[model samples]
Target: MAVTDKSVLYQHGTLSLLVPGLFEGTMTIGELLQHGNSGIGTVQDFNGEMVILDGHAYQVVETGEVHELTAEQSVPFATVHFDDPKVTTHETKLTKADVEQKLLTDYPYKNVFYAVKIRGIFSHMLTRVVQKQEKPYPNLTESTKTQPKFKQENVEGTLIGYYAPELFQGVAVAGYHVHFLSNDHSIGGHVLDYTLAEGDVSIQPFASLQQHFPLEDPAFLKEDFNYAGMSTSINKAEK
Candidate 1:
């Protein structure tokens, strides 16, 4: 699994490096946190968006196709800790350890969290819920712009997972709620291509759809989302 310059590794999306031994494509921050021995590679895009590692990209294409990137450069994934606030500051110096300590002393049970707000289509089927990714194609904004429940200091690392707020907020399909990925907060910058389905429960119906997204947090997704619960038909048509 040694990486060589001539390896010509394959990736999940557009950007990623060639990993050596690590596979599985995706891991919850908590999972990787517990096992730090795991090796990591650059993120890349295949036919769909996926986290690329070593030689293999971690993802599943509804159609069967794996894409390898032509450009060659090392992609860096920083495990940062924010003692300040979660604002637009990409330039910082912090490691995974620093963020972990902040969470242990802050958030309850030493769990990580994100203060979120739902500002789109609330009190109805279209309520936009922006978690790791913004919702409501038109209004891609942070609802907790002014005041975030999960204060910047309370949590650690950027969010990279999804949440189904039914755990914290009542299930009326309204407002925004923080979804927990894993506590890893290590994974970032992933792109995935999505296709349409026959019967989706959400607002719109997507026939041929593709979405480019990133999983910035290292935490594992909240169980409340439970796959079926989290799978909602986004009004992707607007996009």
Candidate 2:
């Protein structure tokens, strides 16, 4: 049988999951979701493929295949800055498969680039069963949200600067990918790095990232820019 025809199964209580013909490991929901700030194992597709990174989400229509965490989907991402001046570099726990690496910088320096593996499940029946019985996903409304320190979007921020390589032509910097998590309501843009460049990169705050290199339109860090529910803009509801 095609993968789509099979059910997308979620864990009994947590967001972790299992899929058709892909169940061999003995990872618990807690063990699977113990990840970086991106909520790696928390992401599951209808097909049972757990997300191993923080990226876009997608779904294959021909066979009703839903993509968990992926590049094709535009999921919310973040590039958080540490408060302490000395704490420039930071890391968020992602999926288990993610391998952390430190790239060399221009002046011959090294910095850590967080490697995240997003989560996604493929069994429709799993998540359905989990949802029907437990319904334990925390009330997101009570959660604290991270946002850009500055209000307006600027073109000088590192996030935007990333798009314009010339902006950071010769600087000691380390860059990596991040996720923009959203709240119950849609607001604030979460900035993440896709690492178009490879070297000792600089990480910036939400405001600074936006100022350094701003996107035309930005989503709040809390919103899920990837693997989102069907969009309402085009009336393309999931059948």
| Per-prediction TM-score to the true structure, in the order listed | 0.18, 0.21
Instruction: Score candidate 2 by TM-score against the native.
Output: 0.21
Each prediction's Cα lDDT score? 0.21, 0.21
The alpha-carbon lDDT assigned to residue 143 of candidate 1 equals: 20
Q: Evaluate residue 115 in candidate 2 and report its C-alpha lDDT on the 0 to 100 scale.
A: 26
Best of the candidates, TM-score: 2
lDDT of 1 by residue, 1-239 (tens): 22221112111111111011111234233232222211222221112222322222232122222233333321222111111122222223333233323333443421222322111111101111112222221111122122111111222222221111233221211122112211232212221111111111111111211211125423212112232322132112101
- lDDT (Cα) of model 1: 0.21
Which parts of model 2 have CA positions greater than 4 angstroms off?
A: 1-28, 35-42, 46-86, 89-175, 183-239
Query: Which residue ranges in model 1 land beyond 4 Å of their true spot?
Result: 1-47, 55-59, 68-110, 113-239
